[model samples]
Target: MSYRRTTDFLLHDWLEVSSLQSRARFADHNRETFDAVLDMCEKLAAEKFAPFNRLADTEEPWFDGEKVHLPAASHAAAKAYAESGMLAAAQDYELGGMQLPCVVEMAANSFFSKAGIGIGGGGMLTSGNANLLMAHGTPLQQQVFAANEFGGRFSGTMCLSEPQAGSSLSDVVTRAVPDGADFEAEPLGPRYRLRGNKMWISNGEHELTENIIHLVLAKIPGPDGKLVPGTRGISLFIVPKKLVGTDGQLTGERNDVALAGLNHKLGYRGIPNTLLNFGEGKFPVRGSAGAIGYLVGKSGEGLRCMFHMMNEARIAVGLGATMLGYAGYEASLAYAKDRPQGRPMGPSGKDATLPQIPIIRHADVKRMLLAQKSYCEGALALELYCARLVDEAHTGAPDDAAQAALLLEMLTPIAKSWPSEWCLEANSLAIQVHGGYGYTRDFPVEQYWRDNRLNMIHEGTHGIQALDLLGRKVVMDGGKGLQLLASRINATIERALALPDFAEQGNTLAATLAQVGAATKAAWATGNPEEALANATPYLQAFGHLVLGWIWLDVALCAQARAATLDHALLQGKLAACRFFFRHELPRVGAWLQVVTRRDDTCRTMDEAWF
Candidate 1:
């Protein structure tokens, strides 16, 4: 019942998603089934997920030549999860899951991820692949392959990055050729016999489950030789770790994918990061390959199909970042209240005689805690907002879904990167709160730092996200993304202005957004699209704040609405967090705006000649 109050405040005041009292509440679009799923998620997260977090971090998974090792605690926890029939939470119930709404899955993920990311990562990847195959795979493909994953009998991966092609998919040299015998003039589908190397694949060598399903991307040679351009000529294949019979059961022929090496990463060690070799032998129908691969979609459409998985993964990365940061903040808050350390700076004999006060009593400690709370909570809100948008895009009636898609696309990079950046700040503050102990493995904050650091790199490095935001999303469909986002933010400001205690912040946000709009317009006209887009990261960040500020304000409105009916402090806590974010975080925009407008030559000036 100790950390219970804070957790309760987070769920109830900010994200209950069930309450209908607030006009600004997200519940209108949320269905009853969604609420039930969300409640279940929070229940298990607090009960089952959070408990084994430290153990997973302590007992990171390992690997031998044959199988990657995992902790027993993870097995128990995953079993609990699997038994709950929640593995395919986002899938159709017909696919063997509870069919939870995406937003709720994200919220529940907040708990599970906060508890343990390493183990949670496996579940997420499996879910993503199940979703991907359901969307693109044939009926037989779904029955044979994705079914086991959705059923929790297997796990899946999106294998795109090789040691050679980390971010640039165009540079992929992993080759695919025909595999089946009596091949026609040209065989279509995921069965072209894939061969190539895939590196940094999560769950690559794990024995956590019996089978590993890899949605692999590779290049196949044209009759003339040489490579193709763009994302064309790249294809995705459902390449199993071992070849299987067409009858949906396992066979013993090793496909091309083999782990060449495993990376001892700075974080997220529970899932093995692997380098895989593919297509080594001659196929019955066609050419020699170091490993076997079966194509996913038509040839030259691998990146497109992979995009489906990447988009989801991007959101997952954001959620992971949010959860880790939130957990660290929660831990710090607990320590601040319970770990009594110091007296007032100017203390009398009476003060000195007093028992050491909780660190929360100190001004500096409050500052740290407030900062941590703001980022962690705001990041979670941003992530949840995106999740809700996804829900809207799918479930909401007509007009709403279009708006949701636009706003969601605009915020994706910010959603992916801001949490990565700010959550790291939260973890840093957590360490500071723990003093020297945080630096040691004795406390999990240090591990939190290590784990959180990878997020900034993994899904798309912050820089890549920035470039995407600026270069593409901003320009995409002639600035529809930014304009759509502006429309929603404007609407939020308008609504909040009509409410009390929020009018001032609403005006402040409105003005800040206007400034952002001005900057965005200026960048749009800046002649150099690349240069303008170079500033996309900062633009994305500014846009994220506006969006998050809107969310916080909405939460404040919800809090006020609930205050009249519920008489609970949850709403009050939400208001306080909202006020803190607006006051403390929003004003920093002046500096970033200056960068976006003034065009700092820092990165541009760092020349090869200077080195």
Candidate 2:
């Protein structure tokens, strides 16, 4: 199915996102306006982004001593996206935003993600950066920094990872010191001088926009002049590439931030990823060595503020992974229908005179195609459902909003990690469907696979997400989040039980849910972190399958409701994918949960010396 058709079904038919018009935040939008937005984005993505997906991949960004050079197509795509007014799609009207529902905005952006994520630029990071400042920065900071970022004159990057500290935030050694005795009097906020090196920073250095807004994390020294240890001392800083005046105009002087080098990557090469040096005396301001930065929020709350962007990025990453898988699935499906292969055996035992049939006619080929459909479509539904929850958390009535937030917290890790794992598998199957042709770069499926492989490690690694799900998200708030999630799942189960066609799948899902709950209890039975998290990955896998099962079943109910009016083939296709997932995919949850329930430590305790 086309991206537009899929999104239309999810937004209007399944989620009924148009109902959001009743909310104050989206009061101005109706189905027409929403369709207009999606149509514009779809056209622009096809025109500017799709044609250059391969160009962006083949002609990777290169540095030329003073600046980085990307394909002109990449630059054009970025400019078009900026002009599309989607960066602030969810912001208020006064802020030059459409004030559309979050679900609608997410659906619109899916077009660009599927077209070419690399060429799509850093709009996600820039929007997330502006969103963070709007939430945490002073009013002046918002006007000067966030406003310009939303306007597309400034791009953004979140500088978190360092060469030594990777994902371990507590080990970060970047330091920020007071700029002067009167630093507190600075107009922007508390002024500081940051000196550190940030690694693997995407869009870290680019000329696509007038400036780059970097939200850097660094340590502030204590009274004794020694840096405080752990994340407790970490703080956020607004370190613009070019110093800006009170009027939000560039000061014409460079800040101390410098691009040390670019890290050549395997995929996503269209966007520059760099090692940045702050306050390294490379471009000293006011005859000083340190990079001037304005502090954001209070001290020691950097991670809290940064999580706002991180969580948003995680969901966006999941969407990107899903679209890439969808792209591959469509490609392989098209290929299967056109490529004639071996003929089916006849009762006569020989059919040399008969023409070869399309590969799609083969049972094994159908199995592979069905797997891809189940994974990609189910993941798409899951992401969109999460997006709908974002809308509810922001705009629903008080009690409902609170419940939405709790459910979102419980599902965020799964939303991010599950698609990253399974969609990449879908991409592999897509390539497999193409036979030998899929392995070559000539086909898009291979690149789709390469690009998707990065999602597993993008926002957070699979292991990190697993730990978050089992260690923190499930157990936090006296397990309220998990309980809220269970309630939502059981409600769907009850609905399915009322239908004879879905009653069996409902029972299977209930059993799986119970097994997951038991595993969760068994994992933490001893209250030991090491023991509980020993098989966290397996636990994550099982939990993710359970969530997908719930999502597919829920989606099937929607499709079934429209079966009388919807296109016969489309409705049947949806039902088939749902059945495929329950019969072929959901059973794997049992094996995964078995390992988790037993707190398997075979891999954890194995000595390196054993090798």
lDDT of 2 by residue, 216-289 (tens): 99999999988888899999999999999989999998999999999887777778999999999989898899
lDDT of 1 by residue, 536-604 (tens): 677767766776787777767766776775446555666777888888888877667676776555666
TM of each candidate vs. truth: 0.91, 0.99
lDDT of 2: 0.92
Model 1 lDDT vs. the true structure?
0.75
Clashes of each: 19, 0
List the lowest-lDDT window of 10 residues for candidate 1. Answer: 20-29
**What does the lDDT read for residue 37 in candidate 2?**
98
